[model samples]
Target: MEPTILQGYELAKQLYAKHGIDVDQALRQLEKIKISVHCWQGDDVKGFLFRDQELTGGISVTGNYPGAARTPQELRMDLEEAFRLIPGKHKVNLHAIYADTQEKPDLDELEPRHFEPWVAWAREQGLGLDFNPTCFSHEKSKDGFTLSHPDPDIRKFWIEHCKASRRISAYFGEQLGQTCVTNVWVPDGYKDVPVDRMSPRIRLKESLDEVFAEPLNPAHHLDAVESKLFGIGSEAYVVGSHEFYMGYGLQNNKLICLDAGHFHPTETISNKLSSLALFAEGLLLHVSRPMRWDSDHVVVMDDELLDIGRELVRGGLLEKTHIGLDFFDASINRVAAWVIGTRNTLKALLRAFLEPVDELKKAELDGDYTARLALTEEFKAYPFGAVWDYYCASQGVPVRETWLEQVRTYEREVLSKREQAAAPAQL
Candidate 1:
């Protein structure tokens, strides 16, 4: 370890000791917490499937950065590079479309063998895997409705796809010795005002019930449902709205996914954590940054991210909450985006863990609002950067801006290769 890191850590330890905060203990706890890095970041949401079309769901990925992963091996290489830069032990979240199979199986026909390579890669890396059903960019979903589609055949197809996704998730857990979180999110809604709003939601409910009909051991797999407010074509109404999923999650004993950008712009998910944790056994968070709507921009160390970490730490819901990234940016180096986002998330969590939670709670319980507010503001000035640097050093990752140079070097050697190969024949 560097002398600067050791000196800075010792000074930070003494400062935090005054507030009854154990800096070393906080570092240990932060190391134990893992943020599931999204695999889509390496490929700009373009899965490994043989589809030649644009994004269909209400989402879009802007920018044309070079070297987007074109194969499972390439994507995994990019992910390995990203993980190398990010500190701490972490997991990777995979979409159903990323299956490494030669046969072009439709979503309904997807099986665990299709994703066997992913499980094998994850096992080799000692990573826990999470799964998501690809509910968009398909012929059936081009109409902007899936589970809630009035067409029984289309709805049935999506339901079967969801069921297949769950089975694959369970297989991942069985193979990797870790529970896989399988989240179902559908882009089912109307573009214009519909007279029969209630009917679509009812159909959606029925479809979900059918998909989850098969019972899987909770020890191996966990199920979650995600809801959205609106999308590009479905601005009028989204059948699987937050309220519907909240109700269903509570009733079905499933994890409710609260996407940061899925709700109204001003609505923050931090406030919903305590309230939902009260009713649900666990929660899954799709942590993303939305420029205007659910844009799925890369996450940063912003106040909203900090608040999320604070809420989880204050409420002691770290173990109960599943933290996963849900953003993609192709404008910059994709691997760099992954490293930046994941590192920032870990930084926010470290900040939360370093907080003197007991002191804050004591002040609140004693009705000392003045002291509580003061302590909150004062703690912000602590040497958090020092502790963060120490943590990175301990984790064998590049400290501070040193990681940026590594990314630049990798871009020169690796990401630039694709651009060179695709360049037009000069003169």
Candidate 2:
């Protein structure tokens, strides 16, 4: 989608003239409206729901997960299958990969000989591919080098993967008419140090430069860069929250793909509100729901998840952005999970897009930012929570208040144990 950038600016300009609003700021902010996914599991939920809703433009996916595809070859098959099953009309990007250094990470072992043809065939079949290595596990990334890893041998491996990923990406672009966006999220940290001491980024950037060292290529264009704020385990190495800035900001080929859930551990990180501020900066979005200290479950319509949708629009991050859905249905009811999740997904998005535009129109004519903001914020919590509640209630579903209490109670117990272990014995 070309995104209504100029139109949005013109609208903002007129609204400013008519209502004395900050048209300049709105217009400036409007330049970075991105609607894309941070992560995804290939499926039809998006096509079935949001394409018609006119909310998101695409979704990101990692085809290797949720299946027995451990090796690169196995993963490629699963990847192809997932893409084929993607029953949506939006762009499909890639995210979340397994590292080679870590105990046979999927795709780490994949040679271009294997990947090149598959990605080519996928293009023939209309499946867009997001090619990159995985992080989050220490075994995968002992020393991070996006384009460059610290170990020379590992660097050699990384360089080869870069070549293959780039080739596949370029191929996808040509065949699909869309850029093969690379979201380079790596875990480049140290176990004993106060911070990620190694200059893994040095190698990472070098590798990236090498990948892009060539002249213009149609098949691949580095679209976005993703960074995270938290990690999975004690002594687990998490690259800096803004590490991608050095890599993507310096390079012309990339954009910033912000994950709202990734920034949750910080109290001051205003969730999706921050995406607006980041939007003004260059690069677009890689949308997703981060499980944050827990399993990376693809939540459908949690309070905070839906809130991210509202923030994206209100912050002007939805204008002409390359947005995608990166959700995980970690629930036992995989099919039902995908369905209700997607149903809620469209509901949340429609509320964000339709209601906000409607309110913005009314507020402009009636001079009611207070009323408009209130209405939007009121629905910010979740677009479909009420409808879901009504449906569940009508169906006589068991109340989840008790389930919620039990989970919270367990968390408290675990935290209390940890705190006692850290604290001195009581007198």
Q: Give the root-mean-square deviation of each candidate in angstroms.
A: 2.7, 14.4
List residue ranges in candidate 1 displaced over 4 A: 422-427
Backbone clashes, each candidate: 0, 28
Give lDDT per model, in order. Answer: 0.89, 0.44
Q: Could you give candidate 2's per-residue lDDT for residues 238-287 as a string of tens digits?
A: 44446555345445545566654555544322263454355333445544
Best by TM-score: 1
TM agreement with the true structure for every prediction: 0.97, 0.57
Stretches > 4 Å off in candidate 2: 1-87, 91-113, 116-127, 135-149, 195-198, 201-203, 215-220, 233-237, 243-247, 250-253, 266-286, 291-294, 314-316, 327-343, 356-370, 377-427
Best by lDDT: 1
Candidate 1 residue lDDT tens string, 193-213 = 989989999999999999999
lDDT against true structure, model 1: 0.89
Worst 10 contiguous positions by lDDT, candidate 1: 418-427
